[model samples]
Target: MYYVTKDLFFPPVSQANRDGILAIGGDLSTERLLLAYKSGIFPWFDPGDPILWWSPNPRMVLFLDELIVSKSMRSILNRNVFTVTFNQNFRDVISNCQNVKRNGQTGTWITNDMIEAYCNLNESGIAKSVEVWQNDELVGGLYGIDLGTIFCGESMFSLVSNASKVAFITLVEQLKKENYKLLDCQVYNPHLESLGCREIKRIEFLRILKSE
Candidate 1:
């Protein structure tokens, strides 16, 4: 059962009873968004779709220390192919992710409302971006929310070959530097598996959310 907020804008669904949906139809206010993140829920919906929240059962995450840089990737890193930065050109990073054409995607989930919401989060110091640049141009990057000791990676895109990988690798290295414990990837994919993401029960994930 989903519980509606006093304003009839937000839902109060139990984390354990997400039903693959934590909430529906709510404005992305700072307070509400913060509360949602604290409870391991996140908003994900299309432009015309109502605000849909999700909290999957088996959470996918990557520990900074557990990142696996394959031999080939290691070679690329060794050659110092691309340079990376953090919290710089966040809007550009997300814009690229949203507009870049992919193999099987017709459009992006990063609606204009979503962009404004996240940019607000960034201004409030809750969300951030990692950028990969070449020849002083933004080639690839990723965006996410950064809790005290956790980074919830949302999405990434690459304009040049392996550019996204470079951005992600830089993010992990920086996380290690900051002593961050985990990078929440949200879902499982072969690419993430190759980069060392693993699955954990939601209960355990919530514990980390609390501890972090």
Candidate 2:
């Protein structure tokens, strides 16, 4: 494991441990966060823990062509029950993600400092949000870093059933329209896999991120 200093740098991704933790104890400055995302690294630590940087092997990703929209989701999309928008109410979207409870999770990683840092990134147009609304209420949404052709998804929340899925499906369709190459999901989860996200070698993911 490596330790980050104030110099705005990270060790090579190759040095990461088996669990993909490359470093610890870094500030969430905008510059540092951007540098980390551009290098295919991201911070994921418990609220009380110091910042932890990871670049996991077998990275979880969703290729635009591989996205799976289930029959039920297709029916939902066709119904037009939810209104989806991008970069709308980013603060609320992320705040909801921070507060929403998840199964097997006792606390949130989206600390106040992390929220502030990502909000700064959003204002600078480096981070983006997708919000789902039923009427005027924001029921679900997600936020992530926009690395040009690749989007590094950070977190998502759903206040109602299938709301987050709607947001995700809409985001993927828009990204496909824009010719995005990939959506970096960071790690594997059964939930994401059900939506067509799959694991690829970390080196392969890095190649895609670094490619022009």
Best by TM-score: 2
* 16: Cα error in model 1, Å: 5.8
Least accurate 10 contiguous residues by lDDT in model 1: 8-17
Give the TM-score comparing model 1 with the true structure, all chains together: 0.92
Instruction: Write model 2 residue lDDT over 105-207, tens digit each, in one string.
Output: 9889999998999999999999999999998899999999999899999999999999999999899999999999999999999999999999999999999
Candidate 1 clashing pairs? none
Question: Distance from true position, residue 212, model 2, in Å?
Answer: 0.3
lDDT (0-100) at residue 205 of candidate 2? 96
Q: Candidate 2, 50: how far from true, in Å?
A: 0.9
Candidate 1 ranges beyond 4 A from true positions: 1-19
Could you give candidate 1's per-residue lDDT for residues 1-212 as a string of tens digits?
34445463434334435456776666788777787777788888787988778887788999887899989888988888888889988899888889999887788889987888888999999999999888998999999998878889999999999999988988898889989889999878888999999989887888888883
Q: Give the TM-score of candidate 2.
A: 0.99
Provide the global lDDT of candidate 2 against the true structure: 0.95
